[model samples]
Target: MINQVSILGNLATAPRQEVLPSGTVKVSFLLAYNSYYTDRSGQQQEKAEFFWVETFGRSAVNAGKFLVQGQQVAVAGQLSGGNIRLENGSYRNCTAIRAEQIEYLSKPQSRTADPDVEPAVANVEF
Candidate 1:
């Protein structure tokens, strides 16, 4: 079964990055998705949801460098289902996703974006 998801949201906080023992990079961020509409009273109403998103490998590393709190971004990934093991010998089945491609929705600050990043997306298979 395919478990892909695409979302466009604003980063609630800075992307936290770390390097694993195996040399793979990890990046995490909080994204807030919102919806708006006119209510019965003719007032605009907005609803929002916050999600904790993460990525692995080079993409994860780039996310940490290019993304910041409040920046808008778009991402596509596969949802993951796993369990969180507690110190009390309990487990909590949790939900998350691994990103495949992430794009910043905001305009570039200058002619040069993040120099560390490739100008275009790479065609590498995971």
Candidate 2:
């Protein structure tokens, strides 16, 4: 069965990086998307949904470098299902995306480069 999904959304949090005991890198983050729908009354409404995204290897490394909280990104990957056990002794079904590819759509407007940091581009034309 094909288990692929693609989504374009805003990052809900900063990408967290971790190094496993075996020396592999893992990066994880949440992506939030807004869905618009019309009710029977014909009024438009918006609803927000969040997804967990995980990436490894070069994809993880690059995601950590270029992605930040609130940035717009497009992710393509497969959905994997698991379970989360709460402290209350209840198990919650969980689903997450194992991202194979990521694309940066836009950056946060409030982000600015520091004077000490070099510009990403030496020259550019609009």
Candidate 3:
């Protein structure tokens, strides 16, 4: 079964970056999406959903530096279910996107320099 999801929205906050001892980098943020629909009474109803998004490795570091609060973004990835225990001792099932490919939705007027790194080479076998 395929469990992929694609979304276009604005970032609720800036991406948070962290590096682990294992050399893995992590980036996390929340994306807010909104929709409007007409009701039976001819009234319009608006709803918004916030999705937790995460990226790892090189992509994670890039996201942190380039993405800022209120910036629009497009993301393609999988939907995952995780849980967090609340202070009330209730478990809340968290829904999030494990980002596969992330794209900027609008033109970036300013560009930030990426951390310098050696060019990487890869080999593929057919």
Pick by lDDT: which candidate is best?
A: 2
Summing lDDT over every window of 10 consecutive residues in candidate 2, give the lowest-scoring window: 117-126
Q: Give the TM-score ranking, best first.
A: 2, 3, 1
Clashes of 2: 0
Tens digits of per-residue lDDT for model 2 on 1-126?
899999998887678898779887899877788899999999999987767788998899899888987788999999987553445667656567899999998886653655454212211110
For model 3 the local lDDT of residue 60 reads 86
TM value for model 2: 0.77
Poorly placed runs, candidate 3 (over 4 Å): 83-92, 107-126
If scored against the real structure, what TM-score would every candidate get? 0.66, 0.77, 0.74
Candidate 1 CA-lDDT value: 0.71
Error of 3 at 60 (Å): 0.8
Candidate 2 positional error at 70, Å: 0.5
Better of 2 and 3 by TM-score: 2
Q: Which of the numbered candidates is closest to the native, going by highest TM-score? A: 2
lDDT rank order: 2, 3, 1
Q: Write the per-residue lDDT of candidate 3 for residues 1-126, one digit (tens) a residue.
A: 999999998776567788879989988777777889999999999987777788888778779878876678999999997653445666655578989889977632333444443222111110
Q: lDDT of all predictions, in order shown?
A: 0.71, 0.77, 0.74
Off by over 4 Å in 1: 37-44, 81-95, 107-126
Q: In model 1, which residue pairs have backbone atoms overlapping below 3 Å?
A: none
Higher lDDT: candidate 2 or 3? 2
